[model samples]
Target: MWKMKPSIALSVHFTVLLLTLSSRGSSPAGKETFSWVTLPATANLTWTPCFDTFQCTKLALPLQYSDPEAGEAQIALIMSPSNYSSNDPNYLGSVLFNPGGPGGSGVSFVQELGPYFRAVIGPQYDLIGFDPRGIGQSTPVLSLFKSPPEALEFYSTYPQNVNESISSFGRFYAQANILGKLAVDRYPTIAESVSTAAVATDMLNIAKALGQDKVNYWGVSYGSILGATFAAMFPDNVGRFIIDGVFNSHQWYQGDWSSSLLDTDDALTAVYDACVEAGPSLCALHDKSSDLIRARVNKLIDSLHVAPLAVYDDSDPSNISFGVADYTVIVLQIFQMLYTPFASGQVIFEALAALEQGNASAIWQGSVTMANDVDLATCNFNASQPFVVGFLDISAPIACGDIIADEDRVRTSDEAKSDYQRMADASSTFATTWYPLSEGRCAQWPIKAKDAFNGSFTQNTSTPILLITNTHDPVTPMVGALNMSSGFTGSIVLQQNSTGHTSLSGFSTCTAEAIHAYFANGTLPAVGTLCQTDTRIFENPSNSSGYTGVTITPLKRSAEDYSLGEAARALAGSNFLAKSAGFFGRRW
Candidate 1:
């Protein structure tokens, strides 16, 4: 759930990452652009007309693969059908996507950005998005709260997340965790059923039902974990897989998060460097050096941690709606900014500047939502996105359930403290607020997977999957992408030299063209290939950079390359993810 403000209630506006298109247009080919519309439903609701040009349906897969009689879990699905016939020699088949929540909804992802993807990957493949079992629209959703309102109240008033006090941890550790047992106690079977491996199996089954022999896929963030799991579990069935903003699957499988922070500090520093580059006119926190800016920000954080700045409505002395701009809110906002820096990087800088002079508007997502009059009803969440509009506590179990349950998995409050310290060591600006998600989240996780895949990551799949990422991913580091690539022989890592969460987190023509090529043909980007983004942050919105793609092993640029770069330049200075509620997600 990304959009953050000091307030307890949160909501998300779905501008989830896909490339920032020049604008929706015709296919790269000469055909008219495919548009979807709201349509009436069929009585059976099986591959029926839905949301206009799309189709919606459900599949009942076994809750427990080992015990078919145990029962079945219904999987909600949606698809944007391709115009090209599968019989067309160049036509690729069905490509399925998972937006990395371990708990995120694939259905919602497709619903929001299916047309954009149709433009991105061309119209040959039938693009599909599904809510993994136990997630949005999927049956038996692993909800801890009875209703959205109750969940919103609990999250809005969450005491543990507000301060860095030991009591905060003790209270949160004691109370928030009961939901784990509550989950198992209530829906024992379904709670135990939503493992990644089981979902992988469901994907394979989904492809089979769709009459495709092998599954083509695109996954981001935690979706990387799901993609790698599928590749490892069903190697022969792999086809044109693309995993971006890679999560080190090894670390994920081990129930550890320490390794993911290697690039976090670097990412924060980059934002400061960019601010200095932009100068005082554009970047409010600009300084002679990045270090100076960091120091100023750090000093602010330290003072706030000691004594939070209380903001009030000047006319109304009693108004605490903006609450206190403290270390918790400050650092947590940094965590939010890290997801998509171009959309949010300057925000923290300006917020810090504003806070120094007594204003807290820029730093608060809740207040912004309020000021913008975004109906809180639109804030609903699925597993992949943490946009706080609606309810979905299943993220805890989806995460906790994956780790084969062990006594070592759950940490004591003291151990939790150490974990926090360790994460803090990794990211001084973070760890305080982020620890709960990366590691602390598992402290109360209860279930272990019975249908877990104990397979090795190194699988000689039918085709070498493609891996892409931003150089400075706030959550999943680039090294993790390299680490995961080592397992899948011949897998190429195409990086967009930019700071953000994933490939989609930034606009890179070189990277996009590389993706198009990979899907158009099985060609992979040459080793040591690096791409430049078509846009720059904190620049004159009118002055766009015409950066195409770059590769270390240089060759003459083609005419097509220039066109893509021109398209990307059209996107310069656009804050695409300013409201990206979630895709592939914030946590993963």
Candidate 2:
């Protein structure tokens, strides 16, 4: 699936909070400097133990930094100190990590990957993770739909065909989103303040609060956009920054969503090739051979346009029906799975094989599994608002805050359908369905950050930045990384000749080794370095975990999670259910 974008941009007052002499170290011209100091406790904060090794704290910063009196919002932060001896003279400083999604929970990211990071980055640096404003665990969390089920309902409203005839359904769907409408109406400030630039500023504030003089960062996907913004805004503070699955900051700020999805078609083809290469022993759909499998899959999708598939749902004790919209959602899920084909390969194979067999059980079963993973507290979904709004319900504002959108580019449902046709012509795999779907939603967003960065990308930073990417990343394509690298002075681009999203781990050992080296000593990989991917698509993983000699607990797949044959069920629904499951299950 494609990343979400806000439809419109409205100008609003911005608050710029600059760190002064007392807060920052005085460095000589063109050189980065930092003076460490502890932050005294404030009246507005509460600190609590997060885990045995980590402490969690909440800080209330001005909702609008430019207007301190406007109000304040709390952001959640979790920090774990380095295991290295504090007395060691060679102890490395703190490093900030972001897993992207603009809406992805950084707290969850740290909790899951901390040990892996500590091993790679060395235990000499503090690991810090925070939920960006309006995101997970942060104050004023944005919830587009009350629950995952509601999100599924919202997605269910999408028109199966792309044409002006179906525009009314889209309009009704947008207006019917009472929760979404209420959210935007109630908190306009968040919409205006959640841009990447603002988040980058938040990063700086986090560093200052932590008494760090310089910043070391590892950001992926949209996080790369934030890192780029941080580099542009506070160039001197930059230290050994690594941006993986690089985002084209220019494209992002300019609100060109289509550019990101242009490569999805090619990536999907690669998945097909990889599946064929795997053979029937490894790939569930391999019995039909590559071209035949594709034909059957396409036929299945086409057939759904005429009549929905009824899949047996053991829980419902009846058949669950899937409409064209539901079919599209499964397609998007397959596309996402292609990102980490090794881990998700089996899932994709089974899902598609079931589709070929006219069985809807696999799709319904996946939905139930996904529903179990969702946090009910975060999702306050009700029956009235049934939509599968992506992780973007919370993320779109941040995107709007960072980018300048052309109001004209924003489209009505009919216009969006037209746009979808053009996109489909270029890339059928994703553009046809996603373009129209996004345009309709984005057209309704009516705010933008006043201080969104659109300045010259060229800047004199304190150190060279490292850029990493996979050749066939479904979301952030490699070309964007190369384009971004050209703008940053001395930035090195390390291309991983692989298929996936981020290349730092599992996807490419060469890339991870290169990153480890850069972290140890701020030396860029030789320019034009092309790292080889060790994971084979169809073969058993040569190295299940990316680490050289470490074992990671594997995710268990249930025996009941099997391919469904042509069994009819009682329920009929759209593809949004599939996408809803993906909300908790990220392709990356």
Candidate 1 C-alpha lDDT tens digits along 509-556? 788788778877878999889999866555532112211121011123
> Top lDDT: which candidate number?
1
What overall lDDT, based on C-alpha atoms, would model 1 receive against the true structure? 0.65
Q: Candidate 2 lDDT (Cα, whole model)?
A: 0.56
| Count of backbone collisions in candidate 2 | 23
Model 1 bad stretches (over 4 Å): 1-45, 148-153, 156-163, 313-321, 365-392, 405-409, 541-588
Q: Which candidate is the best by TM-score?
A: 1
In model 1, the number of clashes is: 14
Regions of model 2 farther than 4 Å from truth:
1-48, 85-87, 144-183, 287-290, 315-325, 368-390, 405-410, 413-415, 418-422, 436-440, 504-506, 540-588
Please report, as a residue range, the 10-residue window in candidate 1 with the lowest summed lDDT. Answer: 546-555
